[model samples]
Target: MNSKKLLLYSSVFAIQGLSNAVIPILPELAGEGSTSPAVSSLLYSGYFIGALLTLLPFGILADRIGNLKVVSLGITLTLISGIFISISDNLWVLGISRFVEGLGCGAFFPAAYSMIADWKDSHQSLGEFNFLLNAGLAAGVFFSGMLAELEIKTAINIFTLLAFLSFIFLLRETRGQTPDNSGRKKDEYGTSKRVKPPGEPHENRTGFKPGMYLEKTRETFFENGFWKLWGISVVLYGATGVLNSNYADYSAGFLTKPELGFAISASYLAAMLSSLAAGKTKAKNKSIIRAGIVLAAAGILFSLKVPLLAFFLIGAGGGAAVLGLVAAVSRVSSSGIAMGLFNTGIYAGLGLIPVFGSLFIGPLGYESVFLGSGLVLLTTLFVKFE
Candidate 1:
């Protein structure tokens, strides 16, 4: 409901955009430095690992400290990491910088989402908010790819500058919204209002016990069907990551390198378009989830043909499918923990499964990875909706 919150959300989303922009270009950059594909893939994987580790803690911290502080800290880290990467000549140093960057970027989503959850009026509007987030990311990735063609280092330079700008804007914009209990005032009823600090022990007056995060956890899991929906989301996100991390590499062998870049850009364009549409769609959760799964499965299946046109179509389909999934996930939960868990599964799947895929892919080939990821999605398709 707050314009300032929305603006801050936009900045957090732009961080995602900047990260996505750099992802597709990593392979080429690694190749330029004579790093192997596996090592190059690690550049991406390391960031996810960093993200996976930090998501929960960051979410908890955001709930306690306030989203703006956490987000500002994260952006500072991102900017520093980018500067580190810009100067590094060795792959290992670059990888370390990326891992640290991921920790910062990883926290941004849940922190920002938590803020949005705290601010928004209707719960359903999260789908639209997420659409905006994804749009920022889509545009970020698109620009990253477009910028990389000029020089990968230069692209990083631009992103680093953007990060600084974001930090400044966020500092100015969120000045009054800090979650620190010290600055807040209480109402006349002695209710001790103003959303209690996330880490503080609320008195028994609130009808919930202290030291019972586990109780809320249990309620969300078994009682609320959180696990069922979360399981499906994990699989979908993993599959999407597989597509994202590899699209440029696979297509490069067929198309000119620049065309491969264009294809990757096109995939994000598809995502950007779909996210925009998702912002407008009135579809129910059931229909959207089903459609997303089907589209994703179909995209993976179509990608097996290995034709240039098929690649483009599959990317577009997968993008649309994921847009649907984002809409679906945003509908279910508002907590940063929920967002963090959802993201953890997705990134974990993306980060870890590829290890297995790499092993089998060498023997069974690229098509197997596509089929296998699709089969995983197909299994999820039959899962009973929560």
Candidate 2:
């Protein structure tokens, strides 16, 4: 990987870390603002919405143009969102800004994934890309946790600055790599017609357009052997979100300190360290993904009572499972569009699980969150390797 790619990946990791660190602290923010839990969740929820809206379009734009340009725009927007959130006094302001930030974040992963895929055409190189991207994500999570321990305002300020600086570092390196505007012939798909770019001088230019859009949605639910993986992803994410949302409260109320940012941060650290081992097993795609789900479920179950080591297991399990799944999916898909579908599947889990988890919280309390996640993982046993 070149320095530019490295920096770009690093900026993404840091941004993800900074933004994600906000999850565990939502409750705290809620109390500070005297808002309800549901309302506070909106802050987190808004981010996902931003992701949902921006992810698809940004990805298509990246494919149409250049990934580096998309990334540059994303980083700038992210910095602005962070700063806006840092200075805002009202929850709505913060929420909207976070949503905007989420949009930026939405662009980050897809563009980054596309770049990595385009850059490295080999499996080994793909593993390296996953490792580096995950490393940046881990580092960001750790720093976010550490920073959140400070005054929320102060932490936001510093994080915003760090995000800006990181973007600058990345922007300098990712110079060329933009989309080709010149007229070029379309590439070969597995089927009859070649996939053409829009506005090309051709017959229909409408090959598999409907099918292309529906690929992820259809496969995720209706396709054979997809339910298991999809179910696991959905459940795992919901469980993670629920637990993450409430962890600070659990720690402040029952465990060692009022601040569990470090605990949360530890999960990212564990993930970072675990990737060192997980990356080695990328060649064994299916096995690694299943192992990740199992580990994550087990970790969540264990952490229900054991506060001291909760994050360690959580980090190890979640990090390994997600990275494994990503590696597996990247290999399965030959084109960038398929990669977007993979991301959408994972983010769907990230997006939907918390909403479901929220419904169970009233009487169920925090432990149920883990149970829900575990149940979700049980489906992983059925996921097909293809």
Candidate 3:
């Protein structure tokens, strides 16, 4: 693990940890006698909203300015927003801060993926990255629960400190350095490697034009079966999102906070393990995706009765599905724009789907949402993907 890689991975861990740290304490944040479920759900979704807005633009900027540069900016924003969330009690302030924090994540992921995709063993590298990503989510969930009794903000403060440190380290590491592909070297076979030149359009061309970014983004969407992967991402992540956004409140009826946290953490832990495993598997991406859909659908359908088991299945399946999807997209176009759009599908599912599901909780109850999500996942199995 070189310092650069370590910094990148640790930063990801910190950001993800920060993102989920608030989950266990949502009730506390909502204030006593606040009856609206929408507040809690909106606060939860705010981060994703911010990420959704920024993912694509930041990705394009990463290609032009450099991935590390974008990552550094992300960390800074994360640190700042984490601090704001820790001190504020106003719902609007917290909501805005959460959005800003999500923007930080939106900046980090596409840039990070672009950098990782350029590595010699991109599949394995992406697997490791996803592993750490879930580990961070798990740790955040667990620790937030553990700390909630002591102080609702403790976990946030701790993770914010991590973001601060990561930002400082990144600044020092990148001081006086400019990001480019100029340092790329030939492989062991002595053949000159082909590295995507910095600032190049998604078409892999040398020169850029005024409207090339939009043109290439449109082309990338229609090329190499990318839309299929994007569709899969939305459905797969949407199922998990429904669970993630509602499960904490739903389980409050039966489980203690710590137990609830553990259950949620279990899902992330499963995902972490599955992602690591998926990286090493030789299975085709399509096959892996299909299998993941099955597992995830089962998880969602049975979530209310077997909360822990269901969550575990969801995490495991989601990890594998994401690994396959990301790997597939990377194969088609490793450009920042392509990675950005791919992640947009992810945030769309995570942020928007849950809010949509919440609308039906009054009339249909949580079970209907879960069942509908499951059915939706199953339906995707029949969709043709080239």
TM-score for all models, in order of appearance: 0.78, 0.78, 0.87
Q: List clash counts for every candidate, in order.
A: 2, 2, 0
TM-score winner between 1 and 3, please give it: 3
**Deviation in Å, model 2, residue 282 alpha carbon:** 8.4
Order the candidates by TM-score, highest first. Answer: 3, 2, 1
Off by over 4 Å in 2: 1-3, 32-35, 120-150, 167-228, 255-259, 282-284, 382-386
Model 3, TM vs. native? 0.87
| lDDT of every predicted structure (CA atoms) | 0.62, 0.63, 0.80
Q: In model 2, state the lDDT of residue 379.
A: 71
At residue 67, candidate 3 shows an lDDT of 67
Candidate 3 RMSD to the real structure: 4.2
Least accurate stretch of 10 residues (summed lDDT) in model 2? 184-193
Against the true structure, candidate 1 reaches a TM-score of: 0.78
Model 1 clash tally, residue pairs: 2
Q: How well is each residue in 217-286 modelled by candidate 3, as lDDT tens digits? A: 8999999789988988888887788777777777778877788788889989888778778878999988
Off by over 4 Å in 1: 1-10, 32-35, 120-132, 171-211, 275-284, 304-336
